[model samples]
Target: MSVRRLADDQVQPAKFAFNRDFAAQAKVWVSKYPKGREQSAVIPLLMLAQEQDGWVTKTAIEHVADMLRMPYIRALEVATFYTQFQLKPIGTRAHIQVCGTTPCMLRGSEALMDVCRSKIHAEPQHLNEAGTLSWEEVECQGACVNAPMVMIFKDAYEDLTPERLAYIIDRFEAGRPQDIEPGPQIDRVFSAPAGGLTSLKEEPKPAAKTKAAAGAAAKSPAPTQAGKPKREGESETLGTSRPVTPTDQKDEANAQSKTGKAAASRSAGAKAPAAVSDPARPAARKPAAAETVASVAGPATPATAGLSDRSRPAGIDRPAAPDDLKLISGVGPKLEGTLNSLGIYTFKQVAGWKKAERDWVDGYLNFKGRIDRDDWVRQAKALAKGGPEEYFKVFGKKPR
Candidate 1:
């Protein structure tokens, strides 16, 4: 939005000179944006002017306007907007900038303000009669823990009791070098540990659904006949699953076995112990399976038939497990979720794409040469079940 000219201040030239090295330095600010955006560099250019002169003057504003091709009024607008630049003349030697935000205010910042009024000057931006000190109340300085603090130029002096700030002010006025001390002057650390934490305890593993507490088999089966992969009449589609059965004496053996595999580990070092039988006393039967599942989100139908052949993504041959289709390399959890939602769950689906479909996924997913990078279809087909276990074969070559 375009700003209006101030009713009080006029578009006059700056009183101070923007020196040789300073003008050269000002060009660096203009370089940050694209061409024709040089006008956008107004704030920084004015700042450069303020740095050259103790406060921005009419001559400095005019210099910045000319340098950045901005109007003199527009340059003054930029100068007046930021609190950092002082528009009035300042002391030749020192300035005390006291913080007035809530934390600093709570920590006796008012006392520091009092000190400024008593020892330096009473108003926000005026120099003392001696011309060696000046003070103003400002905002949070990113050092909230060191509340009740003041800044001298850019360096913060924190944890002020009125006495401490008085001492600091005196030292600055006396031409003494105030070397910064390590750590906060106050008792608090950098940031407090986050509150409402509910998940840090070392939870015990629930008895495995397939094993007992000890993982030893309970009553070693009055062995019943086990069902094979199903018949022609069976449901082929992955269906909504049954509720969880809390592990009992019977599933103990599976627990001790700890056979669950982390597919990504890909080597022997990744495997856990074999399923073991339970030796503990028998489990007392209690609540139904329905209750167990409600404790957490109930399981949905297994993703088995999610996107097989007829339902295959337009250009890909198979489901794309998320990790493979990242925006940049090293895709993490969020990118994987995006791929899964787009129904591009496996490498095969991503690998195989029609030009149009590839464009849609790339644009929809906002992913940047994804489809044409590799022959997704052929590669995916190779990874297809009953095809030559190509996923393992291809990704398996440990590069030299």
Candidate 2:
């Protein structure tokens, strides 16, 4: 490793502080750690300081040590140890780090080094004539599969020929590095087959049905008979029994007595008043059978099931007054309306969401962990109570 120290007094500012933009970001990073452990945030602060000015400077290191409340040497130790922190002045517009590892070397990285030497300076880390560009040969940048790559700041330009590398440097020097796209120079995706995918080029065939699945299908009753199937160990008897008990005989006698009285009254020529069926014996309207729309596709996932339930079908009435769902930080007007349309109107409903329900909503809304990330339930509970007063009591501030 090259010697890493603060630049000469002429090169560094007398004092350094994070600019407003960086101050705000630094505050956020610092807040992530527990109290009195702010020193843990030193590495990121140093990186931010370096990012603010093209590289780490003496004043920047002291500024970070003060911000983190650590000793100057602690901050300096970190700055010197990580190769990522450039201790000297780097090119203001672009500082290129070329990978000179074995894989890159084998793939004509030497030619790239030659290109750098011819175009910029014979010594690495020296600025070009314009002072807008500088480069250094570094160890493996971990994109060896895309060997012969150069990283300008955060972006990696991979699969470079000498001509391509020269073009990239020229573009950066001209203050338009954005003109050159990153990644493989040839037609390929990151580390995939160079030319194109050689295998699994077509859609995969459906897996063969297992014997257990086939047997289950065979055992399933026909659709018409889905309502009833024979119970285990029961005979196929239709309204037949072995013998009558004493209680049955008594019930039969009572029934005969009622029939005799009715016959006698009819035979006596006495017209009985028009009769109505007993309310207790009135005909019943059978309930509709449980409907099943068998999908030709396959079994439903829990996510899909939740989506189906949450999707409001036509003819369901919208609530007269929907709750203000935007009280939750991430719930913008469009998302609130979407939630309302899906019948999730109130914060109470959102607050009640379990992990499974949240997962379902996440899938339904095409969100990637936004619910947990924003602590939607915590916010919703506060909103449902009344407003952010309760939220402030719990979380110490207003919702984002």
Candidate 2: tens digits of C-alpha lDDT, residues 1-400 = 2565566788777888888867876887788799999999888888888878878888888888988889999999998877788888788778888888899999998899898899888888788877877888888888989988988888888989999999988888888978988888888887898998999999998999999999998989643233455454322232223355566667767878999999998889987689777878968565444323434445765544354564322223466876788878888878987887777877778888888788778777778788899999988998788677566455544565
- Largest lDDT belongs to which candidate? 2
Query: Judged by lDDT against the true structure, how good is candidate 2?
Result: 0.79
Off by over 4 Å in 2: 202-400
Best-fitting candidate, scored by TM-score: 2
Q: Scored by CA lDDT, what does every candidate get? A: 0.62, 0.79
Candidate 1 lDDT, 347-372, residue by residue in tens: 55654566666655555644565545
- Supply candidate 1's per-residue lDDT for 239: 22
Candidate 1 weakest ten by summed lDDT: 235-244
Candidate 1: C-alpha lDDT = 0.62
